[model samples]
Target: MSNGNETAKGMGRRRGPMGGRGMTPGEKPKDLKGAIGKLASYIRHFKFAIVIVAVFAACSTVFSVIGPKILGKATTALSEGLMAKIRGTGGIDFTYIGKILLFVLGLYLLSALFSFVQGWIMTGVTQKICYQLRKEISEKINRMPMKYFESRTYGEVLSRITNDVDTLGQGLNQSITTIITSVATLIGVFIMMLSISPLMTLIALVILPVSAGLISFVVKKSQKYFKNQQEYLGHINGQVEEIYGGHLVIKAFNREQDTIEEFDATNQKLYESAWKSQFLSGMMQPIMMFVGNLGYAAVALSGGLLAIRGTITIGDIQAFIQYVKSFTQPIQQIAQVINQVQSMAAASERVFEFLNEEEEDQSVENPCDISKVTGAVSFEHVHFGYQPDQTIIHDFSVNVAPGQKIAIVGPTGAGKTTMVKLLMRFYDVNSGAICLDGHDVRSFNRRDLREAFGMVLQDTWLFQGTIMENIRYGRLDATDEEVIAAAKAAHADHFIRTLPGGYQMELNEDASNVSQGQKQLLTIARAILADNKILILDEATSSVDTRTEVAIQKAMDHLMKGRTSFVIAHRLSTIRDADMILVMKDGDIVEQGRHEELLKKQGFYANLYNSQFEETVA
Candidate 1:
C-alpha cells in the first residue's frame, strides 16, 4: 500500500468548476489572445450556425426593447381621455387602449420565441464542438510516447478530458448569447431614452460611471480571495482523495491523528477564503440596485420638469424611466460575461496545448513482414538512458536462438526490467539496435512487433469484467473450450471454479476481489492462451507458495517446450533447470553458464545462491 503523501504527490493538482468560481489567478491563460485565436479557428467550421444564433439573439433584444416604448403610448392616451372626461368632452378611449396593449403583448411573445430558437441552436452547436474535442483527445492518447505518461500523473491527463472540456462547453454556450443580447439591449434602450428627452438621457448616462466604478472596486477586492479559495479547494480535494485511497495503510501505521490534524489545517484555510470571496461577490447586486434607484430618481425629476414645460407627455416620462432600468442591466450583464470569457479562454488554452503535443510516428515507410518470425532476438552494443545525460544501460549485448529457455538472474535495479522494455521497443536504444530474426525491431510496425510476443509482469492487471472476459482478452477470437484449457494448464481452473460465479465471476476495478497469487495465475493463463512465438515472464511465480510455485514451474516448462522464453527471477531455486543462466550486475552480464557450472565456479552467482540458503537456515 502507498502512503498518503506519496498518493498526494502522484495526483498533482486538482481543479474545480471554472464556471462557478470564474477565473482564478493561477488558472489564467498564459497567452489569452493566442488561445482565443486557436479556439476561433477550431470553431470556424460552425460559422454558419453561429451567424444564425447571432441574428436570432439580436431580433429577440430588438423586439423586447420596443415593447416598453409602445406601451407608453397607451398610458399617454388614457391620461388625455381622463382630463377630457373631467371637462365633459370625452371619456376614456378603452378601444384604442386595448389595441395598443394587444400589440405590445404580441411584441413580447415574438421576443420570447426568438430567444428560445437561439438558445436551442447554440446548445446543439456547443455539444457538437465538445464531442469533436473529446474524440481528438482520445485518439491523441494512443499516439503519445510512453515517456510522456510516465512523467505525469493520470489525474492531470484526465482533467483535460473532464473539467477543461466541461468549462469550455458551458462558457461557450453562455458567453456568445449574453454578449449579443446585452450589446443590443444597451444600444436600443439608449436610443429610446434619447427620443424621450435628451436631458433625462444625459442624466441616466452620468450615473453609469459611478455604478461601474463601484463594481470595479468590488471585483478587484474579491479577486484575491477567489484565487485563494480555489487554490485551497484543490488542495483539500487532493488531500481527501489521497487519505481515502490509503486508509488501510494509515490504519496499519497508526497515523490517524496525524492525518486528521493535517486535514483540519487545510479545511480551516478553505473556510477563511471561501467566506471572504462569497461575501464580496454577494455585495454586487445590492450596490447595483442602490445606484439604479438614484438613476431612477434623477430621470423622474427631469421628466416631471419637462412635462410642466409642455416639452414631453406623461407617457414619455414612463417610457424614459423604464429605459433607465433597462440600460443598467445590460451593463451588469456585460461585466459578468467578461469574467466568463476569461474562464473560457483559460480552459481552451489547456485543451489546445494537449492537442498540439508532439505525437509519436506510428507508421514507417516500409514495414517488415512478421508472418514467419521464429523468435530469434539479439541486442547489439545497446546503450540507453531514460534521460540522455544519465545512461543506465551501457554497451549491453545479448543473443538468443529459437526454442531456448534463458533465465536472467539479478538483484534489484540490475537493468533486468530495462532489458525487457528495450526488447519490446517501449523505448528505443540510444546507440545500438535490437533485432528480431536478423531484422531490426524498428523495421516492423509497433503493433505487428508486439503481437509476436506474450508477457506476464510481476504486477497483474485486470479490468472490470467477468473472469471469462478477462481471459478472453488475450485472444479475442478464442473459444470457451480453449480458454478453459489454458486456465487448467495454468493451475487456475480449480480456484476459478470454487468461486460463486466460477469463470463468470465479475471482477471489480483493480480486481482486488481475488488474492494476489490468484491474480498472478489468471495473468499466466492469459499468456498461455495467447500462445505467441516468444514469451517474457518477469517474476511470474513470485507471489505463490512454494508448492504452487513448483506446480507453476512444471506447467511453464510444458508451455515453453518449443518456444523462445525469457524468465526473470529473484528466487534462485526455481531456475535450476533453465538451459542457460545469465547473471547480471550493474547493467552488465557478470557470469553465464548452466546453473551447476556457475555454482561450481564459486563466483558472484555462487555467493548469491549460497546466501539464500544461509539466510533460510538462520
Candidate 2:
C-alpha cells in the first residue's frame, strides 16, 4: 500500500492527534518549516564547545600546509647540499637540515594532538545535545492533547525520539567540523601544487571537475532515498507497536504468519530504500578515488617530463605528487558529509515536528488563590464534539449544587465521559460554558481548575513505581501517614498489607504485576487522597468483585459525603444511592431526578434498571 503521508494535504486544518478517535485526516505537516534552522538552534546551545572544536580544526588545517612545504625544502636541501659535500667544499649545512626536520616532526605531532582534542570535545557536545533534546521532547509529549496521540502510533514517536535524534548526533559532533577543516586543508594544498608547477596542476585537475559532478549528482539522488528510508523505518516501528500491543488478539486469531507477512512488507520497504541510499552514497568514495588516481597519474607523468627537462626540480615534482595524493581523500570526506546531512535533515524535521505540537489549551488566566473551592457545577447549554461536523452534545444543560451526588446513566456514546472531560478542561465546549463556583472553568488556570476535581478513569494509569509512590502522586507533598490513611479509607490498605512489601510493593510497567481489582482500589485511593471538592469517576468499580465492590461502595460513601461527585458507569445498580440520577439519550438528558424518583417516573433510568434487574433474575 502507498504511504498515507504521500496522500495527505500539507498544513490542512485537520487538527487531531494520533491515538484513540481523532479528527478527520486534515492537512499533513510537510509544510512544517526550517528543520535545519531548528536543529542548528539546538547546536547553538553548545557554542563554546563548537568554538573549541572549530579552533582546533583550523589550527590542524594550518599545520597541515607545513607538511608539503617542509618536505619540499628538505628534499631540495638534501639533493643540492649532499652534492655540494660530494664535490668537497662547504661543510654541508647539516645543522640547518636537522632543525628543519625537527620542526616538521613537531608540526605533525601538533596536528595529531589537535585532532584528538577536537574529537574529545565534540563527543561531549553531542551527548549533551542528545540529553537536552530528549528532555524537551518528553516535556512536549506530556503537554500535547490526547487528540494528537490518536493520529499516530507510539512507536513512530519513539523512532523520532531515539533513532532519528541519534542519527543527527554524528553531524553535530564531527562531520560539520571535518568538512570545514578539510576544505581549508584542500585549498592550501591546491595553492601549493599550483605554485610548484602550474602546468602539472592544470593537467592533474582535468578529471577533478568530472569527479565533483558525479558526486554532486549522487548526493542529490541519495538525499531523497534517505528521507524515504527514515519514513519507512517509522512506519515499520508503528507496525511493531501495533503488533506487540495486540499480540494476544493476533495469537487468539492464529494469525502469526499473516502478522509476519505484514511486518515483512514494511521491513522490505525500509530495506530497499536504505539499501539504495547506501549503494549510491557508498559509490561516492570509490568513484572519486578512481578519478583522483587518474589525476595522480597525470600529474606524475607531466612532472617527470618537466623534471627531466630541468624546467622544475625533482623536489618540486615530489611535493606535487604528495599534494595530489592528499587532495582526493579530503574531497571524499566532503562528499560523505553531504550524504550525512541529507539523512540528518530528514530526522531533524521529524523531531522538531514533535517539539512544535500545540499543547492543550492552558491559555486561561490564573484566578483567585482560594484553598478550597465549593463544588458547584453547571453546564449552561453546552455543546461539544470531538469533531465539529458531528455534534455529540447540543444545547444540553445541567446544574448541581455543592456536595450533590449526581449519577449520569446513558447509552454508550451518549456523551457521559465527554461531560467529565469538558469539566476538567481536557477539551473546551464548542459553545456555552461549564462553570465551577460561579466562574467558567476556562477562566481559571487549567491546573488549578483540575485541582478542584479528581478522576478515576475506566483504565487506571499507574506508573512504574512503588504503590506508595503511585498514591503519593495524587498529592506529591503528602506524608507517609496520610498516604496509608487514604489507602485504608479507600479499602486498598487491606490488599497493600497482604503484599510482600505492603504499601512499598513496586508496580511493574503498566501495573501488570497487580490484579485488576487491586489496580482499581489504588486508583480509588488516589481520588480519595486528592481531597478535591469535586470528584469524577468513570466505570470506577467495573473491575471489582461483588464483595470488594460492596467494600469500595462503603469507602466511596465516606469520600462522597461532602463533595459534588459525577459518576459514569454501566452498572446501573451501583448508583442506586445517588441523590439524583440523570438518564440520557443521544446528547440530551431524558430523565433527571433522585434514583427512586426516576424509578417512579418509569423513564429511561427505570427501563435500564429493569434490564439489569432481569439479568440478575436470570
The lDDT per prediction is 0.80, 0.78
Residue-level lDDT of model 1, residues 1-618, one tens digit each, is: 101111122222223211112234433335667878988886788999999998999899999999988999999999999999999998999999999999999999999999999999999998899999999999898677666656544545666777678878898899888988999999999988878888899999987899779878876676555545544554565566557656787788888898888778777877887687677666777777788888889888989999999999999888888889899888777667655565567567778888988876676779998879998988899999989998888788888899999999988988888887778676788989999999999998876887788877666778789988888888889999999999999888999999989999999987899987888778778878888888887787887898778767766776787888999999888889888888988888889888999999999999999999798889
Tell me the alpha-carbon RMSD of every candidate. 5.2, 5.9
In candidate 1, the residue pairs with backbone N, CA or C atoms under 3 Å apart (3 or more residues apart, or in different chains) clash, namely none
Q: Lowest summed-lDDT stretch of 10 residues in model 1?
A: 1-10
lDDT of 2 by residue, 287-348 (tens): 98889988988888888899889998877877888888877778888888878887777777
True lDDT of residue 388, candidate 1: 99
Clashes of each: 0, 12
lDDT of 1 at 221: 70
Best by lDDT: 1
Runs in model 2 deviating more than 4 A are 1-33, 72-102, 366-372
Judged by lDDT against the true structure, how good is candidate 2?
0.78
